[model samples]
Target: MGAAVTPHVVDSHHHVWDLSVRDQEWITGEALAPIRRDFSLTDLLPEARAAGVTATVLVQTVTVAEETPEFLALAADSDLVAGVVGWTDLTRPDAADALARLRQLPGGQHLVGIRHQVQGEPDPQWLLRPDVRRGLAAVGAAGLAYDLVVLPHQLPACVKAAQDHPELTFVLDHVGKPPVASGAIEPWATAVRMLAGLPNTVCKLSGLVTEAAPKTWTVDGLRPYADTVLEAFGPDRLMFGSDWPVCTLVAPYGEVLDVARQLTGSLSDGERAALFAGTATRVYGLRLSEGS
Candidate 1:
């Protein structure tokens, strides 16, 4: 708990995208314009260095089919990117082949997992679909994981999906995005507990800072969900993430880590290290040197 187990940490979640290359189609407001300009390895590394984050996992920000190789190429050129969780169509018949193609791309060795923005899907059971289950199985067979980026309401489907494929690793992003902004918890907490009961699933202690009043959220604002996830998933299944640039929308990168440290102050040293860095390294197969 002393000083939050400060280490030369690894930020397990963060992203870099360029709208000039192709419109993200997700950044639609002035609040998001700073990122729309261009966020690449060059833009992220300095900030990460200044904040003491030595390595990062570059996550998928767009759902486009081609973005995986684009992210892989970016990884090949940088040391900061320790792993890449790019995307592929999980619903396609050739989903397994598509995943194989992504691995052949440059820097694809850095590829650790597959993610489709399940939160964007209108049908809650989309993840539970038979074809989607086949694709997830393929990912598991290939020794890759699947990340669950879903809304709170989608937790039931996520739980079903996780149980349906116990061999596939599943990561829950943003604390399943609880309604901390509105102070509501009932069903979200219930569903999250259910999802956590699955042995193959883990949750990211990230993206919560932006879920509250950006300028005003305190450790208290994040505490309930953080504590719940800690209790539900325990140290082994929970990992830290910065959720950067998007975090810039609410708090700076350091502040996000600061809050994470503060909320987890009661844990043992090993637990803190796991949440802050160890778990991510194991979960993502990050290639780290002493410098990283």
Candidate 2:
């Protein structure tokens, strides 16, 4: 008899942090108290393996330059981490040079994409700034994708940026972070659809659990948002991401995976496979071994 092929599930987004190394200033409020401690890859591997996740993309948590190298080194040593979406000072003039330096470092081959906390920026058009646009150009020139971690209102800028940098693939994280807790989807939905209209853009079906009402979110509550992205980006351009540690604020890692599975239950086997693995692998250019 022939051997059964294991499904190669890829967790396209997730994060880890160490408190002793640096303080996550954003984790100060009581609402984020539960996850204020160190969350290392050691804490994630067991959960990921149990969820049938063969590989994961470790995303940057802070905008610190030192953090990217640390993440790349970690990816170099781990079999589970297939790629890294690290952060660099995109506003700096040496953005391209910085990217080149990063690619030459240990585990540099795993640096698949770059991201900045555009969500935290006060300016909605931060991505459209002259300096940021230059950085975007550098990102594209370096043959790397840019991960957009922006809020709903900032999606318009994301659309414009994608249009301007057609060479760069803009990955929209958290489906542009919809207002799921309020169950409002007008502006967010409209903006997401516009962003999805760009062929160079992709969306991640992640972080929705935390966006919903704490401790009470259901798959049905997330259906509309998920459906919006699925229909807008299509399964081939949409990928699955756990958004762990942060998602743990609302649901456990296993529960988050189960919710995502339920939300995508109606897709065909091939479509589901694309969402769970194929899309991320293609977008990030992840290198996976046989059976992984």
Candidate 3:
């Protein structure tokens, strides 16, 4: 038999935070208590290495302006982190300037994209807000992608936003956070198909485990949602993300990766390669080491 092929793996989504540096206010309530302490790259590197993760994209946790620079610095210091999806106030008039300033900061080259906690916004159509749309344009002009962290109901606006700015790449985080816990896929599935129809849109296969009933979620429980995105976006536009530390709220890092592997097992080797790493490298413009 031929030797087993090991595809190059890149975790397209994950985060690191130091509580002492600044409070992660969202880490409240009993359900999030397990990850409430500090979670730094120091803690994640070993786990990522064990999972055969060659590189990772450190994403923002809060909207605070200081967080992005900090994450950039962390990326600069770490060999494992290849990119960062930081946050900025998209409502600001000089959002483009802010992006420029960020690019000038230390380790700025690692800033691959930007994201907002759109799921928390009360307005379902928040992405269509004029100011936010303008900022998204700036992101595109800066040659950076935008990560969508919206709920299922908000996907229509996401489609509109992507339609409005064909120049920008819209990366759907957590596959619009499907209602896996309830097992209802109608609206979410339909909306996902709409968004996927747009050429600029891509998706991440992360966070479904948490969206499902945390205590009862199984690989079978997650299959439908995974299949929906797989069929809609295909492997070339879908990337794997651990959403770690947060994923620890349900399954450990390795288990989360294992689930993703099982979900994508039916794909051809080249397709699996794109799902695990190549798509992220292309979408985020990541610069991996020579042999990695």
Candidate 4:
């Protein structure tokens, strides 16, 4: 018999941080205390390898200016990290130059995208800011994708941003953080379809387990939200992300992967391949070698 084919897995979203190096600042409250300590790429390597993840996108955890460069250095040294989605002050007048400088830094070749915590912005339409728009244009000009970490309400602006820059790829993180715990899908579902209508947009099937009631969340609890994105964006535009340590709040890294498998079980092998690796490889312009 032919050897069983091992799926080529690319974890599209995950993060690493070291408290000794810098503070997360966002991991506040008792609920987030479990992950208060340091989480490094060394810690994630085994977990990822065990789960068949050959490559991963190391994402930005905090908005600190230094974090991106640090992450780039880490990615440069590690075979597991194929890409880095780091943060930058989009509102800065020199946003374009800032991106260019980041590219010139050590390990900067691994830099595939840029992200800001739009969820924390006080204004729902924060993406529409003039300076931010210019920064986004610069991102497109740099030939990099943009990762959107926004709440459901902010999706309309994401849609507008994607519409405005057809040349740029906007990856919607965590299915736009749907109200999975509440099981209320209307506004989120509606908004997701609108965002998916734009050809330049892609969605990550991640963070749903944590968004659902942590202890009580089952595969069924996450299906609707997953289904919404799968239907709206299709498998070619959807990718899997472990969400890692943050997902540890609700489910372990392995459990998160299992849940994703269950949610996408019905898809054909090629479709599942797209969700597991192909989409991310294409969207981030990842250059993986044979068997990676």
lDDT of 1 at 201: 94
| Residue 6, model 1, lDDT | 60
Q: How does candidate 4 fare on TM-score?
A: 0.97
For candidate 4, list the clashing residue pairs, or say none: none
Off by over 4 Å in 1: 1-3
List the lowest-lDDT window of 10 residues for candidate 3.
Answer: 1-10
Error of 1 at 285 (Å): 1.4
Could you give candidate 4's per-residue lDDT for residues 1-292 as a string of tens digits?
Answer: 1112328789999998888888889999999999999888889999988888899999998889999999999988888999999989989989999999999999999999999999999999899989999999999999999999999899999999899999999999999998888889989999999999999999999999879997787787788999889999999999999998899999888778878888888888899889999999999999786669
Each model's lDDT: 0.87, 0.92, 0.93, 0.91
lDDT of 3: 0.93
After best superposition, candidate 4 residue 47: deviation in angstroms?
A: 0.8
TM-score of each: 0.96, 0.97, 0.97, 0.97
Best-matching candidate per lDDT? 3
- Per-candidate Cα RMSD to the true structure, in Å, reads 1.4, 3.1, 2.0, 2.5
lDDT measured at residue 277 in model 1 versus the true structure, 0 to 100: 83
Candidate 3: which stretches are off by over 4 Å? 1-6
Compared with the true structure, what per-residue lDDT tens digits does model 3 show for residues 1-292? 2222346789999988888999999898999999999998889989988888999999999999999999999999989999999999989999999999999999999999999999999999899999998899999999999999999999999999999999999999999998899999999999999999999999999999989898898888999999999999999999999999899989999989988988888888999899999999999999998756
lDDT tens per residue, model 1, 156-190: 99999888898988989888989887878878999
